[model samples]
Target: MNIASDIKPDRRERALAALAEKPDGVVEAIAGKAEVTPAEILEILPQGAAVIAGKDRFIDIWSEMTAWGTVLFIVHTDDIVLEAEGSLPAGSEGHGWFNIHGDSPIGGHIRKDNCASVTFVDRAFHGRRSCSVWFMNDKGSAMFKVFVRRDENRELIGDQLQKFEALRDRYAAS
Candidate 1:
């Protein structure tokens, strides 16, 4: 069965229209209305955003993220959103998982099997065009988010934005 049909057309249209009116509120709100996850909404984001199937390229993406100088690494659960700011730790695969170990605060053995996709989210935050790499799980839940840090004027760091654009351009699967 096409389960998506469970949501009526009018409801979906209203949700999408609401999203167009306020992109920032779209994911969670629409997902709730549609009975889907935020990651599901992320996949159908407008043209400017890129959703990349990243299971095969997890390591490559991880490696690139490590070089971003400093970034905000975030994880969340039902209760709280935990954030760590620093370079991503160098990681290696062992025992069927990606082992992250370094002085960096963002260190843990990421379960390789849980990673399902990555999304390059484009939006504005704090008056600056926000850019982030979101790693998601099999159920389309956000596993973590890595954000490009901004400068004193709340502007995206030039080199980091360049790298982010390059990575998204090079890896976004058609």
Candidate 2:
């Protein structure tokens, strides 16, 4: 009963590909006990966030037994970005960037409630910021993630973000 076989690809790859279809997105995956049903997983959202959800199986990269399961979701990345502390980045009129939001292992936790680092190309092309949002630990390495991206079309960008935010207010689970 291996559903992963029917997909004919790895779940992480499959999940990433799903997010790729949307220009700006927030992809997510969670790995816990196998007996945990999908319904239970969906119940963990904040009391008000419309999280467009999905299901795909992931091999436990760390487990000795390959029998455990994982769940994935891809929300519009901007919803989380709007939670940023500073002004919304005016993405290059027609460019994109990885806006990372999470706690950095350093004193980042104490400095900001939501520590965000935007990846903007600086004077030097090599000096670029890495964008990511991962579920990590005390030492700060990701165990899981909420994939994020942003687009600069202002109109379309605002629409997509509003759509996601509206969904959150309507169907946010916790």
Candidate 3:
């Protein structure tokens, strides 16, 4: 059985209702309140709000983001949220890991094999339009999130937004 499909109708309704009522609410907070994983939340989000692709697209997605200029790379846990602001470094696969090496502030090894899904999320965050790509593990937890950077006026960077939308469309179509 598909675990995501096992979520009760009421739970799905509640999640959707929460999004509708508080469009700017943080998804992680909503997931916590609704007792669902963030991945499950994304799955139930309204069409156009999210598009999920397979882990096999990991390298392709990351490669595309490398040219998006400065963006926010976030790793959130119960205790802390780590934010790194920089362009995604191009990565190479070797020795069971995807290693990122560059002059950027973010550089590390990612076990891409453990990634189950890559979700492109376009939602309102803190009352601002936000776009992010979430890399999620098999357990439905986000491994990391890369957000499109905003300008001084707090608007989504135009070119990056276009690129993000294009990527979402390309993957969502296939």
Best by lDDT: 3
RMSD of each: 3.5, 19.0, 2.2
lDDT by residue (tens digit), candidate 1, 1-174: 012344457655665665566666635556676666666566556666745656778888889888899998878655778888899987899998899989888888888879887778877643457888888887867788898888988788989999898888776645
Model 1: pairs clashing at backbone N, Cα or C within 3 Å: none
What's the CA error at residue 72 for candidate 2, in Å? 14
TM-score of each: 0.84, 0.22, 0.91
Better structure of 2 and 3 per TM-score? 3
Can you tell me which runs of candidate 1 are displaced by over 4 Å? 1-15
Model 2 ranges off by over 4 Å:
1-34, 50-149, 152-156, 170-174
Error of 3 at 120 (Å): 0.5
Per-residue error for 62 in candidate 2, Å, reads 37
The deviation in Å at residue 15 for candidate 1 is: 4.4
Clashes of each: 0, 4, 0
Which sequence of candidate numbers ranks them by TM-score, best first?
Answer: 3, 1, 2
TM-score of 1: 0.84
Error of 3 at 9 (Å): 2.9
